[model samples]
Target chain A: MSVLGRVRARPQATAGVALTLPVAVFFVVFWLVPFLAAIYLSFTDYEMAGTPNWIGLANYERMFADPGFLNSAWITVVYTVCTVVPTIVLALLVAVPLSRPGRLNRWLRALVMIPAVMPLAATSMVWVIIYSDRGLANTLLGLVGIDPQSWLTSSDLAIWALVVMVVWKSMGLFVIILTAGLQALPGEVYEAAAIDGSGAVTTFTRITLPLLRRTLLFVLVISVAGSMQAFVPAFLLTGGGPADATQVLPYYIWANAFPYEHMGYAAAMGMVLLAAMVIVSALQFGFLKGGDE
Target chain B: MRAGTILRAVWLIVAVGFMLLPVYAMLVVASAPDDTDLRGLVFNGFHLPENIGLLFGEGNLPTYLRNSLILCVGTGVLDVIFSAAAGYAMAQLSFPGRRVLFALVIGTLALTPMVLVIPVFLIVKELGWVNTFQGMMVPGMISAFGVFLVRQFALGIPKELLMAARVDGAGEFRIFARIAAPLLKPALITLFLVHFLAQWDNLLWPLIVANEQELWPLPVGLANFQSEVGITYHLTTTAALVTAVPPFILMVALQRYYVAGLTFGGLKR
Candidate 1:
């Protein structure tokens, strides 16, 4: 008998299959079914109170035309860019030096991860206090000879304030991830560069950046997805407020679905968000294809 | 030390200070007397116990804390067990459709919680599980990332050990229980930490499904209290500190496992 046939005939193999059945079935029911339902609900007007009515493409059409949806989509893009770029740059700055093996660097690394481990809801509450009129942030700004700007109350500044908090909260994990990538880099390349008398800037730009492309891509994609789906800061700190300045897509979806009962409309917006994430991830893979080689 | 090393040391200290500043502010506010001036820094410890006591005595925070513990611990244990079992199967067994099953698992990784929230709520509603503990916990019991991580670790286990046990007429369950389970301890611990943190910090889904005040978890409860009371910094900061203490303790105690799991899950190549 063929090896495949022999393996299939064994009771142990059947046991393995049986062991996997519970999770697989659970996922199918909870994950796969709901995912399909989300798509189906996107195409229909399914209010929680009533049965779904078939209304193909109308929800998507409304999504494109609605000012709230358009504004949220724009805000989401801006937030993602603002948060991801600064996070990667700052994390890289901290991580490169911290990657050096030392007692101090090790302690610093643990210290930085504290914010990332804390619950965002709790942290957002703390930030709301900091952004208050007579809060510590303003006190620090006053010491630097600046005015106490309204952080979460200003239309233009609220989104930026949210960005700052998010970057602070998330940078630790990225720093750790990038540090691992840095430590994994072969030291012989650095030695060769040093022998050639390559300057620090040139070595970093040429050797370190190119080799860390895969890790950078990983960080970038995760950060973009995270920033896109961010809800706690908006919900807790600003309530997507100061005239909807910080009203990103996920918050918009929540508003429409729960409070307004526009479940179908929310589902359509969610589909758009999913599509955007998939496209971003696919483009990242395509762009970084040569990094592995 | 050289000038460059000194500069780097200064920068590291500043970075650490920046990271801890907000937390320090939280501690100050939570522990400050209610009528104290809120403008400048007031680091006091007199009101710490009183504020925490008020949070529990005046509000439903103790119930929320209990619910959070139930959900996080329940989901953590279940996620580890389910993921380990499926991971072991994919690693050691030669069953048909294994490749397809594994691919499906990986595919689910791309589906974020935001995307699943609405439909999952609908499913819970359909099953009449809204406002219940099982509603909050059951749907999230299995994590795709956990399964992937465990599978990667399980692949490193030698296949010969399992084959040896099988040849000795031991049942597959016996081999898994007596042999594979112990070998998977490190991976399971890592997976448990990851799932526990995720569940512990979860806010959105719980807010949607558990509308009943008695059923609310820490995040949702804290958020509701903030909005309802409209920014009473002393009480809110105390609540925040109370909510943050569990994960803070866990991260500090199991720092290595927490860091490893996060980095491992992120840079899975």
Candidate 2:
């Protein structure tokens, strides 16, 4: 109490006070201001040009009935499932063996992370080329004497193509994360499984999978959160075309908010996405925390 | 052992191949001199220099690259510094409302900026920050993930070290610069790479904030390249390659930091 009193008595707390003020003010002006304004504007019919008129829950009600909104929500769910499952599984399978420290492991791990750091927009563009009818992918298929399927334009296939690109770009970070978990695991558990004549698959399923639960949950939570808000690739590659196949939630929000000037409706959609992310993340955290106990 | 090792090697080869295909394709398309054979599978001929010259000659490729570098460096430095300072405060200092502030930071991470983009656009418009680099980078300069990363590292530093410094008449800021900051070198480097990559690859915000061609970053610049050069695959791809190269170089050079920073958020011990 005396040390605290003495610290409070110091004059520097007042002088040093001014230094922290700028950061506080900066955070408030940029983050808090926009966030609070958004919450307010979400309840009002505020097109860009004029003053807002209060219309409570009208935006939310309209969003619920909008087929585009519903479709985007479904597409987002599918995208989340497609991207998350493959990324986590592939990363874990790659990671378990690469957990050890060695020259070969180091190089292999580096290779895995290459895609994770690549500029996504550039990669998406490259993918647009590869997914072209006459592009490298089809050309390679030609080598194998298989037909070149439309990857981007086809309504049935466009979202999957986007999913494939996302998984390829994002799986590296998952690998690195899962590999870290593998390395940090107690070696004795795997040794015990090995001594019991457990094969690779057996050890993986029995020993590794259970131990990596928390890491898996973390990856899933983040992936789901990210996928639910997918925008850039969907915007660039598909443009939500071919009957709105690749139109995910964030794309819907962007369209409504920016181009349509339906600020209130977009805000309602944003709130929905925000709720989805929060619920999924909370569920994952709760499950993981319970597992820890 | 032979079977398992072979399987692992094959799996790695396949994964690595899939991983580099985009990069390889970017390079291939960029370097292909003529549109004579867009259907070719083999990547044999490439006039990379010619394509690069063509792209730069087209419109503002050099300036776009410069703008990207400026925005990325500016955002990276400012984000890392602010996040580090705030993380240190949250981790070490017994300030009032610390819990609330920390929760607020973490909560910000949950609301993906994509959802906030419209509101942000309105705010930027209100401030008349449109078409400015400051407008592009300033709003993104405080990342919750950056704070989380720094805090994870800062928590590892002993309180005694800071106490000893304070006892020797070192101010809190001096102590941070002299002792705590150096101790956080690895973490700071990792966070910097993450921030730099995020900023470098950011497209939507920059697209919304700046309409001037001169202010466009690499991603936005590449998007416009195709429009301007209509069907000039070589020039477009070449500019795309230019956009792709910096992040690739950064990844290769700082692989450890990049990987660690990336996984830190997702992988708990």
Candidate 3:
């Protein structure tokens, strides 16, 4: 009722308040209020008990000098760059071929999504086995005669292992997206290009790539956002690693908020994560420019 | 076949093989006998029932399953209703600040949900909702993506149909329920399924708030099974298969709709 009252109190929103009340409540409770609280929380020293003491900019200052915080920030950037670039490239590689119609292509289309559609937490567990000493990774490597490497335990490989898991699980959905983009390419344009004696690469670069820009931008932004928020794989597969190799920001932020009870620090990190996503996502808007379509 | 065709086939095979290899390992481990080597994907004999029993018995899987279902189904239903109602109102009904509300919806769709985690946790904790069902479910009940999906679809709905309902003396909410709703079925289904999967796949939120084991969702429970010390590979594999297999099978069963829903959901975000 109070939520309703406040929602109605908004200037010039009186009419149809009944209809918009739930949405307003959700906006206020979930988005508006929490968002503002996050701003305030980041400036304080709240540890889930006692009053929050204001210490403006201290949390943000501490992050630059804190090794663990810096490690997480650096790894998160590495994780995103490693993931989003490969995912888009790999998805394009698969999507272009799968765009055409065939029985096998149809099967492969759905096959790729099996990983994406499943729960990440559950699939991360499967990755745990895959990276295990005697698991499929080793089995396959033995066939190639490469000695087994401690994949998840090795600090160098732990983040890469999680990267592999994330790419495997997430790339397929992007494949589907890019495939849709490819298929939507005007067939006559491709025919015209081929008639002009254009090679496959030329046709792709000039025709297909230019036309797929919108969908590519869509995929790029979403993948960037998804990778920015990834926590489950790090949590499940590597437990943030033998060292801090895979302690991406979400996992590290959760550790601080819950285990260490550093609520204010986590809030500050969350703010930075949000700001980073906005900045990175804005850079991706560059994809939208210079496009005639 | 041309050389290009052969090359494409090889690429497809390698790519598809990469996707399915882990799933195959999961199946083999899940199917292996109880005493079979955990280190390998040895299939001595099928012991699926025994593993199922182990999960149900000692694994306390049912509780986790129920928790996930409660969170998933509840969030789905609430999401559909709220998004649909609001979408209809903002799209059709004359309301003050509709423009502002519309802007807010788009604003939320642009924001990453990770930043909301701390603030929402603080809110839930302040409400003493930690380890509670509402704590797990309520904050996630309405997504801007769902609202945006519904509003876009609802905008295409002929205003005459809704106006006719209003002319027949039906109330606003009633018109939405009876007329606007049936028209928005496809979008609503997409919204529901997408949010359902989101809730089910969610780990970070449930992990933060649902500290008690009883309230843990499958992802949380399943991750715990894998990450905890001294757990055998078989049990963890079984849990993994159990958590993963259903959604895949469900996706396969509803292959076209599932893909369409996911793509729509993904692209919209």
Best by lDDT: 1
Point out where model 3 deviates above 4 Å. A1-15, B35-42, B167-170, B226-231, B265-269
Please give, for residues A29-145, the per-residue lDDT of candidate 1 as tens digits.
Answer: 888998999999999998888999989999999988899999999999999999999999999888888887889998888778777788888999888888888888898999999
DockQ of 1: 0.67
Q: What is the lDDT of residue A292 in candidate 2?
A: 68
What ranking emerges by lDDT with the best candidate at the front? 1, 3, 2
| Candidate 2 lDDT by residue in tens digits, A95-168 | 77778677777887877776776787887777777788778878888889999999888999999889988988
Ranking by DockQ: 1, 3, 2
Q: What is the DockQ of each candidate?
A: 0.67, 0.54, 0.56
CAPRI level of candidate 2: medium
Tens digit of per-residue lDDT, candidate 3, span A1-293: 79754643342233356667899889988998888888899999999778799999999999999999899989998999999898888989889989988988988887788777878877887777777787788887888999998999999988888888888877878887788777767899888887899998898898888788878888888888889888888888778878888899988988898888888888899999989888888877864765664
Question: Ranking under TM-score, best-scoring first?
Answer: 1, 2, 3
**Interface RMSD after interface superposition, each candidate:** 1.7, 2.5, 3.3
lDDT of 1 by residue, B1-269 (tens): 38878898889789878878888888888888773545437676568898887777767789989999999999999998889899988888777778888988988999866668889998899899999989999998999988888889889889888877876878887888789989999899988888888898899989888889999999998887766543377788888899889998988888878877866844566
Give the whole-model CA lDDT for all candidates, comma-separated: 0.86, 0.78, 0.81
